[model samples]
Target: MAMAIRYERPYSHSAHWARRLAWVGLVVFLAAALSHRFGPLTTPHFLVLAGSGAALSALAVVLSGIGFIRLWRVGARGGRAAFVALLLAALPLGVAGYAAYAYFTRPMIYDVTTDPFASPPWLKVPVAHQDFLARPPVTLQDREIQATAYPELTGRRYEGALDRVLEGVRKVADEQGIVFTGEAGLENVISDLEDLAVKPDGDTGGESAITVVPVPSARPLEEGFLPRIGGPSDVLLQGEWRSLVFGFRFDVSIRLREEEETALVDMRVASRYGPHDLGLGAAFAERYLKALDAQLLGIAGN
Candidate 1:
């Protein structure tokens, strides 16, 4: 038996584009809603921000409603459907608008609380931590970032050739009163600078990459091991060199708090380099981390 087939050409290109637009708007809406729910749901700032978002959403919908009334005046039969879709699209507009407001309005005078381990799910593992994780992720500019390309960015801070990073770390541990400081754990270090690329230029550009090494590990996070999206990532090793390069990109950030609390955030560096740049990247990373880690260790100890 042959199956009957029917073809309808009722859907126009304009409608197709409209549907695509609706989907895009929906994605934006969902993302904004999730961020609002997860990022700052309980704070007073969040409430204020959400209120503004709701108001903006109402405004956009109201504008569309006015347009709908105008369409009805023109004798369009289904102005109602247009109004619904238009209002829905404007939902995300409110989200984006309010988020912008939150960006400029939130108070920067945050107080850090010391509740101990408020560890997120991504930070947990079935096995006990052989060592603390490498430095936690960071939010640089507007995005979460990590130093995975050069060792210097992620490694121990050094004052100069006379300074050893390990010694510096110990000194800081004593200063901060970090009592649990036997071997916090090892960090993944890197040596290549070429693989790190950002958006607006190559496959990714508008971003710059460099690495540092030798920083202590911090607590883990509640994120999943998502597949790399291609940027800069590091893998640690137990060889003459401490870190290895197994991936292209990594996202990292510092833990956020309402106040200034003691937080230990570790960092790492890694990369795949060419024949000529092995020393180039490693040396740069080492130098960078030496100085940077020195600053951090000072903080940790203090």
Candidate 2:
């Protein structure tokens, strides 16, 4: 007897999403081409560009998964060739096509880190599904410190990005401190940390007060498809943010820009949602602030 091959069809939901992602991904590819054909995506809006592309890639992934399930269930008798092509090329094509645009367009051009800094690869898998495996990081009082401007990132444009956010956080902490502990600022900082960690993307997780956007906010000169069509997973990162309320754990991503260089400072203590963690997101942030301050001290050597 010939070895039997299994034929499986995709579930309804999976097939639906897969079809949707394929269409969306194709549109993104075309927009990228048009952008390159005309003028590349410009500054003050690069983050939005990048965030959109990243999100589209994610949607493509969702679609591909759906299609694969369909193929597995239905068998390749009807669409085997198309299924195989998409399954193999889905992510690679997305990565290669978009990466090429990113290299040339560089929409995330924040002018922060000229020198290379370390960053792990992409989440590599679903953040929600992955096990924390450890406790989250936290910080204590008297540890928080301020960050300095990078030498390469000049001009007021970059600084303007964080000014409002920094001021709002600082002011709330100060006000809360007068009535609570003189350490109100620390509490406020922790509260903000909580917001970042817990809130999910608007579509799936529901919208919160916080959302990420480009620096030096501006309305583009003309309309474009990719920018016009926003999708889920626009959120680059988030945390549990319990440090502000119940004193849970958290972490934050710090971007540095001075002159023309942009650098990222990601401070973590323990692990978030991990079994062993002390759940101290604020405390870790406090520690990061201190470490940043120390780095500044060494660089300025004062």
Which candidate comes out best when scored by TM-score? 2
Give the per-residue lDDT of model 1 (tens digit) for 82-118: 4554656666665456545744543221111111122
Q: Each model's RMSD to truth, in Å?
A: 22.0, 22.8
Number of backbone clashes in candidate 1 = 57
Instruction: Please identify model 1 stretches exceeding 4 Å from their true place.
Output: 1-20, 28-67, 107-302
lDDT of 2 by residue, 1-302 (tens): 89999866434554455455555655554455445334443211333343454465556566556556656676423244334335533553655565456445422121111112221112221133223333232222112211132222211121122223333333433332211111111222211233223354564654544433223312122233322111121111222232332232233323222122212223222232333222133334454444333333222100
> In lDDT terms, which candidate is top?
2
Whole-structure CA lDDT of model 1: 0.33
Which portions of model 2 show Cα errors greater than 4 Å? 1-13, 43-47, 73-302
Predicted candidate 2, C-alpha RMSD:
22.8
lDDT of each: 0.33, 0.33
